[model samples]
Target: METPPQRNANMAQIFHRSTNFISRFSLFAGIFLAGLALTGVLGLARSPYFTRQNVTRSQPVQFSHKHHVGDDGIDCRYCHTSVETSATAGIPQTKTCMSCHSVLFNNVGYLEPIRESYRTDASIEWVKVHRLADYVYFNHSIHVSKGVGCSTCHGRVDQMPLMFQANTLLMQWCLDCHRNTEMALRPLDKVYDMAWRPAANQAEIGRQYKAERNIRNTSELSSCSTCHR
Candidate 1:
């Protein structure tokens, strides 16, 4: 048998650029970004967490978060309009589903549960996964106006096949983000799409809100009494 040629350990490099000048530089850049991605994944895994992968799931209706949030590119406000101004991201009524499916599907496949709900005059039982205790007052608008983006806590809904609660929905996790400004937020609306960081410092924006509200400190952010009885 003929002896096999030894493989060069470094030759496995994916980029075939022959110019050493740019090739080495590209190699380092690729490795750096790769390391960053690995670190992010590790951080998510170690931290107390939830994701569309784990949030209250198994919707009997088989609605697609990805379709609405992804292909249609519908803003959260279109359906859960209250998030911008209310405490809860109110669930879309059966009418909302029928409004679209009336002409879209023209079949009962997607609208069956909705039709049944309408016939019975009952709300479709959507299992909410990210539930905070009654005493914990969570307001959607305050977080949005304070520079918190939706994706930070909810994860990437557009990419999820089924919606899962992406955040741990725990008090500690909220506090942890409150303490760390760097990882806290992103472009205001970007939260609905994915985890995006703000181009500018969010602390400055928060300070403006502070002055507007006249609380003057992070202490005003949230207290037990603020949301609780």
Candidate 2:
């Protein structure tokens, strides 16, 4: 009355015994490769080729911050006039260079560009070393007023034979300072001092300066609009 269902000889196993292991190994290998690819992309993004850190830029005139700030002890404000009062650190006009070079090295062969620019009332095409993305908005005055020194972001310019990007200038780098800003504060008088260092009690001093200056909190400083807008 009951005919037992007979297995068909042609019906073979759809999967091999090793199929499970192969499937699992394939999944793991794909995941590992994906992770490796992501890591490589992230590393490349932060590398000097992308960030331009420590890479010296060629300039129209071979101006040396070392000679100006180190050898001659010239102040930063002499060239960057608007640093204290404006969003931009204003580039020095040809006249500013003429103020010194007119007498100091007026006849020098290399000084001809300065003379030509001044004579023609045209600006010297000085290549900018520190450049932020166009979408980023940075103010020199605000940072200076808060006791953030020039060398804090610019590095030891007095020691550089040619100006280069000392830091990565990445969003993460800015966020690091914004998150722990007190550590970067100094006396207002020392804002331009390239060699200024914190004393043994700098932590205490920085907190005091932070309070006195009423610097914004980390949340505000690190907010998207702070730099982006």
**TM-score on alpha carbons, each prediction:** 0.65, 0.89
Q: Candidate 1, residues 1-229: lDDT per residue as tens digits?
A: 9988877955777665666868788999999999999999977865645333364468878788789888888787788878878888788888887788777875767668887887788888988777777878778887776656777777787777787777666666777765554456454445565636554656676555445544424454445565564
| Strongest candidate by lDDT | 2
| Candidate 2 per-residue C-alpha lDDT over 1-229 given as tens digits, one digit per residue, 9 for 90 to 100 | 9988887867989999899999999999999999999999999999999998999988778889999999999999999999999999999988999999889988999789899998988888877778899999999999998999999999999999899999999999999999988899998989999999878888788888888999888899999999988
The number of the candidate with the highest TM-score is: 2
For each candidate in the order shown, give its overall lDDT on alpha carbons: 0.70, 0.92
The number of residue pairs in model 2 that clash at the backbone is 0
Cα RMSD (Å) between model 2 and the true structure? 3.2
